[model samples]
Target chain A: MKAKVYVMLKEGVLDPQGAAVQHALGALGFDGVEGVRQGKVIELDLATGTTEATVREMCEKLLANTVIESYRIEM
Target chain B: MKAKVYVMLKEGVLDPQGAAVQHALGALGFDGVEGVRQGKVIELDLATGTTEATVREMCEKLLANTVIESYRIEM
Candidate 1:
């Protein structure tokens, strides 16, 4: 089975990288862009019967820093 | 308007970050994980009437490295 994890910074967290990208866009003449939030996706090809619980555990333990980031899992 | 850009390393491209993460998972005992690919998501809050063409241009120019990465846009 295939699974995907989307990890993003929590609302209100400062994202310097995103801000830098937004600034770069403005410099590049993409003035219509208002804001940008950057995140990551981790795609996994898993063995059969890998439970959602295990994936969630993976996110909690290693994939995401829950204090400042949140993650969603899809299979 | 809102737009999302997902940028991923093209198949056959080497991803050291993904490989490192996969190795870490194995070290932490996630034996069922077969493979992992890491990508990025850029969420954009755009001005009204921002065309998809402009967004694609942004991806082409700044968001993705078309030489080794491909991007998908969602609105």
Candidate 2:
């Protein structure tokens, strides 16, 4: 089965990369742009018997850094 | 208002970075993992009256490369 995970910076984290993008957007004529937070999406095709718990562990252990990010898993 | 955008590779695109991560996962003892696809999530804090249509256009024009990826918007 396919599992999709969304990983995002926790609230209050400063995203310099995203800020750079936002600045570029303004220079490129997108005046209405406000703020941007950048993150990652990881899609996994898992073994047939893999449990959600295992996937969640994967996110916690390797896929995301809980110190600065949070993750949600979808099957 | 806040808008969340998800940008992901097309179904058949090769994701080398994701493959690298999967390989590392296996080396780190996550044996049941299979395939991985990498993508991006961009969160936007918009002006109060921003329209979803404008956000969608931003995704198409700058946030994602339609040649290889697709995007979704959430309010």
Candidate 3:
């Protein structure tokens, strides 16, 4: 099975990396960009019969920092 | 309007970060994880009518390193 996890910063959390990218975009003349939020995608190639519950456990345990980030899983 | 860009390392590219995360998962007892690939997502809050072409230009110019990464845009 294949699973994908999308991890993103929580709302109201400061994202310095996203700010840096926003600044870079401005420098590169993409001023139309109002705001940018940067996150991550983790693609997992799993063994057959891997359960969604296990995948969710992976996110809660290691894939995401729940205090400052949120994660969504797709299988 | 909103746009999302998903940037990922091209196939055959070495991803040390992903490897490190994979190692960590094993340490944390997620042995079912066979392989992991990490990528980035950039979410853009744009002006009311930002063109897809412009967003693509942003990906080409700054959002992704085309030499090693490929990007998909959603609007």
Best by the DockQ measure: 1
Per-residue lDDT for B7-66 in model 3, tens only? 999999999988988899899988878899999999998988899999999999899999
> What lDDT does model 3 reach?
0.93
Task: Estimate, for each residue in A53-72, the C-alpha lDDT of model 1 and write its tens digit.
Answer: 99999899899999999999
Scored by lDDT, the top model is 1
Poorly placed runs, candidate 1 (over 4 Å)? none
lDDT of 3 at A66: 97
Those runs of model 2 whose alpha carbons end farther than 4 Å from true positions after fitting are: none
Worst 10 residues of 2 chain A by lDDT: A24-33
Cα misplacement distance, residue B32 of candidate 1 (Å): 0.9
Model 2 TM-score is 0.90
Full candidate order by DockQ, most accurate first: 1, 3, 2
Report, for every candidate in turn, its global Cα lDDT versus the true structure: 0.95, 0.88, 0.93
The DockQ scores of all candidates, in the order shown, are 0.92, 0.79, 0.90
- TM-score rank, highest first? 1, 3, 2
- lDDT: worst 10-residue window of model 2 chain B: B25-34
* Residue A63 lDDT (model 2): 93
lDDT of 3 by residue, A1-75 (tens): 899999999999998988999899899888777889999999998989999999999999989999999999999
Superior by DockQ: candidate 1 or candidate 3: 1
- Model 2's DockQ? 0.79
DockQ-derived CAPRI band for the predicted complex in model 3: high
